[model samples]
Target: MKYPSLKNYINGQFVASNSARTIKVVSPVDGALLSEVTMSSAEDLNDAVEAARIAFHKWSKTPIKERVQVFFRYKFLLEKNLQELATICSEENGKTMSEAIAEIEKCIELTEFATSLPQIVTGEVLEVSKGIECRTEHVPLGVVASIVPFNFPSMVPNWTIPNAIALGNCMILKPSEKVPVSSGRIAELLKEAGLPDGVFNIVHGDIEIVEAICDHPGIEAVSFVGSTKVAKLVYQRATNNYKRCLALGGAKNHLMVMPDAIATMTAQNVVASMSGCAGQRCMAASAMVGVGPIDHIIDKICDEARKVVPGENLGAVINKESKDRIEKYITEAEQQGAKILVDGRGAKVDGKGGGTYVGPTVIDHVTPDMAVAKEEIFGPVISIMRTNTVDEALAIENANPYGNAASVFTQNGGVARYIIERASAGMIGVNVGVPVPREPFSFGGWNESRFGVGDITGKSSIEFWTKLKKSTIKWNPEAGVNWMS
Candidate 1:
């Protein structure tokens, strides 16, 4: 399928970079040449920034009703072309078709929420003293930038874009070079929905582009979602430059299966969470803490995982690099004395000889010191670490540097309450596998998993993208008070 446009969308137009450098887009499913995207240079980013600075004056001044109307039309356009966008996302990002469609549907819901910005962006009004009023209003931060990861390309960008734009902040989106097409399509839809030139821009490149965004004086804030290592760097550099930053890093999320937990349901949820998107999700349950005789759970998960057929039930990782990395983790785990229960290495997908497929792999007898257990594999690999008590499981989960997400399976309310309250993770799942907060609630992490003041998505986004200004007013007509005084 042809992409919307292979060029960067800057200044409300599809344009090529000054360097004319191109990154070849390839399909992970079959390693086919999809398209070539123009890579933006520092100079290109400067131009985009200039355009955004100009647009911000008007966009910020635009009435909330008008801004929301544009988003309404954008939402309709998204719904109108849902299938087309979903297909593009799946083909480029190597996710299943249904997964991509579901991502688009979520994006639609986010847009729907954004259309009610007039209500959500409301500030506090209070009466102080006699005839003296005090209130606070939320206003736009100048130019903001968003750096989204390749996994869930279509969905992650919406975590910032709609909220930033709705709050009247001009935005520059830097999509992962691995899957840039989906954001390009979104830029097109934004323009179609009557977004003016420069209000929203897309810049395409790798590290240099990202560094430029951080160091650029024009950018007031930066929001990012990526590996923990990179996120730390982004946070430091952006904040060092005196710009606000919200860097959401990677996770080594754990799914603790208690003895009382339903074996079948726990296993099913584990498999679904760990293997979804080939385990490329940040919230993918890569570690399983087995509290008791969890042998049945592991066996069922391994059995179901082995049956998943690539290109049907599962898809390839983003590229061969990811596939190789996942395989190396598996091999290293075996060498370090961990048992490879079901090896995904060398697994074959039908008619996809060149594809980057790593079938679902499970490793048993994982220890805390094991590299595979500590790191974010970002693949369809689940490792079992047995613990005798709930405290042991909680210790294992909390010891990780990343506090992105964690879940516990139990029938007891007291145990669930204990885990929810004591676990260091930001987003917790009691019975649910992946606890991604919906539109209104903020989604964030703790410790190394997140940096900055506010979270992305939901109401937190409004605060992240806007600044607050307080006003104190007094009117004393009887005393003839001077306005300046």
Candidate 2:
């Protein structure tokens, strides 16, 4: 099922790119040519930025309540076409149907959160002195942009769009060229939901466009989600240009299991965490540390992993390069003396021999120094390590540079609390594998996982996309005055 050639969404119009270079949007499911996206040039990016800059003046002054109505219609349209969006995401991203659906559901959830902007985007006021009043209002930044990764085509872009626009800021989105189809569809929905022209835009490209976004002076801030290397570079470039930026990087997330953890339940969650989305997500459990004597749990995890059939239980990796990279890590771990308990290399899907499928692979006896154990493989592979105590397990986790998320699987509340307090990661899960916080809690990581002052979602995003404007007024001469006055 080939799709039409993709176009850039600029100023609320689907404009075809003039760039000579184009990228083939191949379906990782079966190596089919789904679409061809034009590589948007830096000139295209400038056009988008200018459009957003022009729209920001009116959009920023638009009342918060009116801005929220767009999201209300957006949420309804998203739910109305949930299946279509999920299918597009699943085809382009190679995630399973259920996973794709869940991604859209998350987008809808964020849209629902954006609809509450009228209530939450409130200001503070107080009479600090006689005849003098001080107050603070959350005002939108002029123009902002979000560079979203391909792993989550719809959900990740929504991470910034709904909140940023609902708060009255215009946004430019650079969707990964690998999976740009869903974002174009999303752009249509936003327009149908009555988002004004130039309020939101989508440009497709690789590094050139990314660097353009960072260097574009018209943009007031930037939000990025990608690999650690790129995330850091984006943060530096954006900040160097004196723009507020938040760049969420890659993670080597660890899931530690205690001896007291329920073997069946723990194994299921561990397997799901490592194999979900083919383990391409940042929140995936790539490192599994068994604290104390938990051979039974390890065996159970391996057993559960073995049952995850490619294309049935687990989806394919993004592409052949990712599949080869994951297999290389697995092979290296085996050569480095780790046990390949369940090898996913060369896994195949029925009638889809060209598909890039990697089954659920389990590597046991992995040490801290192995590349598979230390680095982010971004695949459906779990490296199992053993530690005698929780301290040792956490020591290994803490030593890792990326601190996106860490989870503890145990029934003991004391041990859970102990790990929670010292996990070093920004997000922690007790008995939960993927610890992505729901709405209202905000989502971000510490250390290298995130670069910037605030998170990309929830209330923190409100702060990221808007600036505080404080006003101090004196209606009349005051008899007494304080230092603030």
Model 2, position 368: C-alpha lDDT score: 97
For residues 260-311, could you state the per-residue lDDT of candidate 1 as single tens digits? Answer: 8877788778888988888999889999899978787788888878777778
Which 10 consecutive positions of candidate 2 have the poorest summed lDDT?
476-485
Candidate 1, residue 421: lDDT: 91
lDDT for 25 in candidate 1 is: 89
- Per-model CA lDDT versus the true structure: 0.89, 0.93
RMSD (CA, Å), candidate 1 to true, equals 2.0
Candidate 1 local lDDT, residue 67: 90
lDDT of 2 by residue, 264-355 (tens): 99999999999999999999999999988999999999899989999887888999999999999999999989999999999999888879
What candidate 1 gets wrong by more than 4 Å, as runs, is 1-5, 479-485
Best by TM-score: 2
